[model samples]
Target: MDRPRCVWVRKADARVPGKLPIVYSKSYAVRFHGLERLHPFNAAKGKHIYKALCAEFSLAEGSFYEPEELTKHQLRRIHTRQYLRSLRWSLNVARIAEVSLMAFVPNNYLNHFYLRPMRFQAAGSILAGKLALDYGWAINLGGGFHHCCSNRGGGFCAYADISLLIVRLFDQEQCRVRRIMIVDLDAHQGNGHERDFSNWDTVYILDIYNALIYPRDNVAKLSIRSGAELPNHTEDATYLRQLGRCLMQSLAAFRPDVVIYNAGTDILKGDPLGNMDITAEGVIERDRLVFSTFRGLGIPVVMLLSGGYTKASARVITDSIVNLRQHGLLDLSPL
Candidate 1:
């Protein structure tokens, strides 16, 4: 007696004959008039990355996958009813978004203007997870909302896409995926997933982050199977060494059916939020290292864009994708 497969994955919402395994959508942008400018995040981050991929890889707008908006029932798979209801209040949304003006905005328009983008990105993450199982690698231009867990949302993360992706994979049983490893190198601890999978032996969390950053969750630190606490303004050599050692050690201890790489560019130099001094080249190599490692093992990998406060994050992400292509890690040759 086998479990039912995920119907969502059976449907074709992600790829075409020519499209790569990358996932993205135009609706991923947060366009609340000029209010989005308040946050250091570039509202058009997904769009810019899409354009860059198009230029570099010669892909068209149609070549990318556009995910459907996640329904409330779908969200309930990971988020509790109480947490979901809390989002109805504009005040809570304002706090999560870090935008005070959102409190005054009409609650009716909140989902249409702001939360919709996040929901779409969440859906994209699920799609990417399924695609990774088939293609060996998949990249969602938006997602990695790691700060939000099952019962809470914070640090500009309104959804627990990471948890949902793993849960969906496990529940669906469409992809023989039981042991999942999360490699969160986002400069801040991924307390959301940590809290959700605290005692789950199947989920291995390897989180490398700054010790002095936001959401310094001591409780969540206990869940990290292997990670490092970096000092402020840690440079390339030290960061890469720590990452290399952690990856090698964790893989030797735990074997995962799938790898979720939270490729956050906030660790870049001059990032006001991440507070690390890793250069642009460091970021590129960081992505390459993660991709090459898991892909070399014949294990499927899914990469998600998490937190990057600076506008230059878009370019850095674009360049990194190109580097991945150049290194023969990303196969746009239609697998």
Candidate 2:
């Protein structure tokens, strides 16, 4: 078959200041302060690599699409009215507590207020879902804000964009999608997503992450094995083998109408936040296993660049997009 339609939302405004802004510090918190700055680079870098790959592979860029905007009512479908109101209110509130300023807060408070990347991030996913219905494949350059919940925001996410998009699409009866699968491969477990979708039957989440380290409570109590605590420093082969089996089993059982892939590069061994040791080549293989399997099943897949902390992590993101392009997976048109 021909290449699937790939949709990427590239908005320059979504970039945020790093978590720890101090240039130097004596504590671990200080060293990790600048983590949020990595998002823009992580998001932008992937497109750079994908474009290069498109040139090298002679892929047709016409198959790609970029969206324009996402409406607030669409966001309200997944988020509480009070939460959305609070976010807008917080944007104008003066003397807000330092602790209350989170990653999901408007960009103005963070110094790059003019960019407003969060709006684009939310809009991008909505666009990806719409395009996925039309072309059978799509991608959003910045997304995977799984930590944001229905009413509150934790982690670096401002809104639970993916969940809201899914809800809106279902409510509108857009494309007759009945069942959807979310495959989260970020280094951190999607704790917020698990909580939000726990009661929903139509959505199934398959998350893979290191057991130990950040977000200590990643795996559900029922899913944990006796010795599964602290899965840091795991061997690449072992991780891949286990992940492959899980993917196969989940796909077979759920047989979803659409699949959302959170391609996080933080699983690399040297990733500042990630404790795992997956190599560049290993990351490529992981993408292949997931994308190829879905392609074989004729299931439409939407891709998102989730998380990556290492300075050199851009290469892994680039490589994954390149592989997707070569396999006729990505639509490489200009945004």
Give me the candidate number with maximum TM-score.
1
Every candidate's CA RMSD:
2.9, 9.9
The C-alpha stretches of model 2 lying farther than 4 A from their native spots are 1-47, 50-64, 88-115, 173-175, 217-230, 330-335
Pairs that clash in candidate 1: none
- At residue 137, give the lDDT of candidate 2: 68
| lDDT against the true structure, each candidate | 0.91, 0.61
How do the residues 36-71 of candidate 1 rate in per-residue lDDT, one tens digit apiece? 989877778888899988988776668877799999
Give one digit per residue, the lDDT tens place, for model 2 in 1-335: 11223344342332123211001111101111453443333434445544554566564553334444456776677778887666555442211212333345553454233124555666677667666654566677666777676876655566687777677556543335667788888887766666677756677778778777556554332332111233778767987888777787786667878887777888888887777889988898888888888867788787777677676676676667678768866544422
> In model 1, what lDDT does residue 334 have?
78
